[model samples]
Target chain A: MSESDRQGGEPEPEPERTSTGEYVLGGLGGLLVLLLLGFLIYQAAVVRDTGPELSVTVTGVETAGNGWSVHYRIANTGGQTAVQVQVTGVLSRDGTEVEESSATVDYVPPGSRRSGALLFSEDPGSGDLQVRPSGYSLP
Target chain B: MSATTDTEHLATGVGRAVGGALLFALPLFMTMEVWRLGHTVERYRLALLVLATVVLVIGLAHYFGAGPGGVSRAGYLADAGVALVVALLTASVVLVVLAVIDPVQDRQSALSVVVIEILPAAIGASYARSQLGAGSRRPQAPRYGHEVFLMAAGAVVFAANIAPTEEVVLLAAKLGERNAAVLVVLSLVLMHGFVYWVGFGGQEEATGFLRSFRNLTVVGYVAAFAVSAFLLWTFGRFDGVGLPVVVGQTVVLALPASVGAAAARLIL
Candidate 1:
């Protein structure tokens, strides 16, 4: 066979070589991406510091003919403002239901306390009262 | 190309598209299924049901549809099933940790909040990353991740509208007329974020942010939101259906579409 016919095709050009700087830059870019990912994770996990605890005190319990009045004292023990404070509780006597009520105080400033009363009709022979609070996290 | 080549190409493209769609839809469907399961059964049972349903759907899809011409079908199904299971497992872990540490005594709302709000967001993030090739060494992953982040950020901001408060008093004080309008606009932006992320993530291979954002998935969400709004206005519970419910429904619809897109992209 003729030499030209025997040869399949011309040789292809060689692939370009990457520079050391290019490789290093690529590696650095990957590292930066990884660092960004770590930062995102940290941001997601970090919880902002919430200020202050609100102290709730049951001031007094007074009995009347048909019902009893329970008094509350809500004090902000935190350095932040507390808004729309609602105290809820059930009054039980001798392990039986006496009454349930809630009181709402609009806003309580830092280092301040507010008092309110709620009345329940069923007489509690005499039992300790407990109060509970629920609302969005205080600002 | 030859007829056979053309047919093969068409099939491959369809397979890729479908796979992407399934990937995008799977997470959203799983989220809804979880929410439903939570309402009906115990947490353990809900987890079991989700797993079983996922396995069954994938197995059946593969068995029924995967054939000589359906290689992509089986692969996409598997991808979607795995994506959902991973997302759910991650969510469960997060929920368990939250419960152990914080112990939300009011389990109902707490569970609902996590399943509905937080889990979806996380899944959205992961889906975005996966699309962008963050989970793989593929060049497209970072781009996908960026797009996903943008979409999720948008959705999150939009969803912030419904933060529970004591009453309208708080709403009145905080959300003045101008503020409310701004919030509504922000919510729209958020919805767009989710749509763009999911839509782009669902392609056979992840595309650039602009391309993905303009895809059918994002368009579908925006369209659905608009249609739902129109529907509510015409025949919803108040004189007009409330915006909150409308937004919620829009999000719900968007979830499945996004998952389907992601699956399609991954599998195809």
Candidate 2:
């Protein structure tokens, strides 16, 4: 290192040119920041939530073995995140509860969805199969 | 020949930047809570964080050039821009490799994940390319305000690394009021020692033991504490907690953050 440099003195003169490419890159970078900030503000303004509003829907039913598997999706529409979400699926025949199963999702963030499946000995298609989120804890 | 040399020099700078980003962000990348926080953190706060990071990078790039460019207003802006790009790219690649985000299916989540990791990586990138690259230019001595800002930046880097974990909350709950007070005093003493006594690079001139202590050490600790509280709040650690718990958690995180502040003055 030069003595001047060692003493934290003035740096040795060197070319300090600002190339066209650097200008363009800087413009692009500034643009990216603006766009990202705009999107985030828009999202914040538009999306309103009181708490975690969770709902479950049956996406599909498939035969995995002697019985059938009920594929379900849990969606949280609220603003807050829910943890240890318990999604329960019930297959009832003639208003009598026949088979029931529940799945636990570790997390379901707001405006996000998680998928799981519940299996039963009876085909859910034959019975009135209902899938709904049973309960959840605040994250 | 000159143009070719410039291209080669930029390539080397870029290479070191990638190395720095990965090296600094590795802990965060592997952290499970951070992965979750990527998607769970409030959108507005995330946006503010990105803005803060941009401003910080520009400040850092002022001191440390991103490449061989001499210090100029436009040059530093461009350098800051390049560092931001390097940070984003590094974050995207690493998050994908770790399977933390599925960009194809989850664009918003992926963006959030990338944004959360960008700050530290950008700092590392700027620091590496400027200090580690060949033909490195020595940075100008920072003013007092910038020195404090650097301490806050360092505190953020260190505190963010550990804030997402459950341990902060758990430890705070168990620390009790007495131990918490002890920890606070210990943190202050350590910070004072590191600021003056420890033979770290860029050590501030000890005008007097009490003077430097009052100025840098006390101020730095306050900055670290504020930074710690902000980070914990951003991570939602203060969501449903009581005041005592919040204070304890802030104190817990402030310990490392204070050390980080001290170390930042020394190293950065």
TM-score of 1: 0.29
Interface RMSD of 1: 16.8
Tell me the tens digit of each residue's lDDT in model 1 across A61-88. 7886678777778876554446677788
Evaluate every candidate with DockQ and list the scores. Answer: 0.02, 0.45
| Top candidate by lDDT | 2
Cα misplacement distance, residue B77 of candidate 2 (Å) = 1.3
Give per-residue CA lDDT, model 1, range B1-268, as digits (tens): 3556535533443344234333433343343333322222223322332333343233322332321222254343433333343343344455565442122332432343333332233333223323321111222233543334333323322222221112222343445456555554554454445434455443333257666545634553454344323322222212334555445444443343334333333332
**On residues B121-205, what C-alpha lDDT tens digit does candidate 2 reach at each position?**
9888877766743335545555788888888888878887888888999999999999999998999999888867776666566
Query: For chain B alone, what TM-score does every candidate structure achieve against the true structure?
Result: 0.33, 0.93
TM accuracy, model 2: 0.88
CA deviation > 4 Å runs, candidate 1: A1-139, B1-71, B99-110, B118-129, B132-221, B224-268
